[model samples]
Target: MLVKYRGSYEKVAMGLLSFIPDLKDLNNLTNEMTLYQKDESHVLYLWKNKDNDFSGVVGVEVADKYIVVRQISLIPSERGTGNSLEILDELHQLYPDQNMMGSFDTTKLVAKWTEHNRHLNTEV
Candidate 1:
C-alpha cells in the first residue's frame, strides 16, 4: 500500500531512497527529502508491504497537467517482484485525472509500466 510520507518516516524513507544510485549520497538524499517536505508540488509516498513495513519510496512532482515521477526505489528483496509496477499502478489510480509522466531518472521504468498497462487493456 502507498502511504503519504510523514516526518516520522524520515529514516525509513531516506534508507529506501538510498537504494537509488543518485540518492546514495547523503547530501543529495537530504536535499531531495527536504524538497519533498517543503514544496507542495513535490510529494513522497512510502510503500508499506503486506507485513506493514515500508519497503520502498516513490517521489513525484505534481504540475498543472502531469504528475512527474521523480524517483522510485525498492528494497533489494522487493526488486523484480512486481512491487514497483504495483506502486505505479496505485499512483495512477490515486490521480486518475492527471496524466502521469516520468522524470529523467524514472523514464524507462515508467515507460515499461505504461506499456504493461496498455497491453493489459488490449488483452480483451
Candidate 2:
C-alpha cells in the first residue's frame, strides 16, 4: 500500500530516494524531501507491502490536470517484484478523477507502463 510520507518516515524516505541516481547527493535528497514535507503542491508516498515493510518511494506534484510523478525509487530487492504497478495502481485509485503524468525520469516509466497495460481489463 502507498502511505503518505510523514516526519517520522524521513530516514526511510531518504534511503529509498537515494536509490535514484539523480538523488544520490545528500543535499539534493534533503532538499527534495523538504519540498514533500512542507509544500502543499508536492506529495510523497512510501510503498509498504502487506508485511508492513517499505520497498519503494513515489513523489509527485499536484497539478491542475493531473498528478505529476516527480520521482520514483524502489529498493534493489523489490525492483522486479511488480511493485511499481502496484504503486501506480494505488495512486490512480487515490486520485481517480485526475489524469496521471510524470517528470523527466518517471515519464517514460509511467507512459510505458500505462501503454503496455492499457490493453488489460483488470488492475495489477
The digit string of per-residue lDDT tens for model 2 on 1-124 reads: 9999999999999999999997899999888988898899999999997688998999988877799888889999888777887888898898877789978888987897688568674654
Residue-level lDDT of model 1, residues 64-98, one tens digit each, is 77899999999998899999899999999888888
Q: What is the TM-score of each candidate against the true structure?
A: 0.96, 0.92
* lDDT (C-alpha) at residue 73 in model 2: 91
Model 1 whole-model lDDT (C-alpha atoms): 0.93
Alpha-carbon deviation at 59 in model 2, angstroms: 0.1
**In candidate 1, residue 86 scores what lDDT?**
95
C-alpha lDDT (0 to 100) for residue 36 of candidate 1? 92
TM-score for candidate 2: 0.92
lDDT for predicted candidate 2 compared with the true structure: 0.87
Clash totals for all models, in order? 0, 0
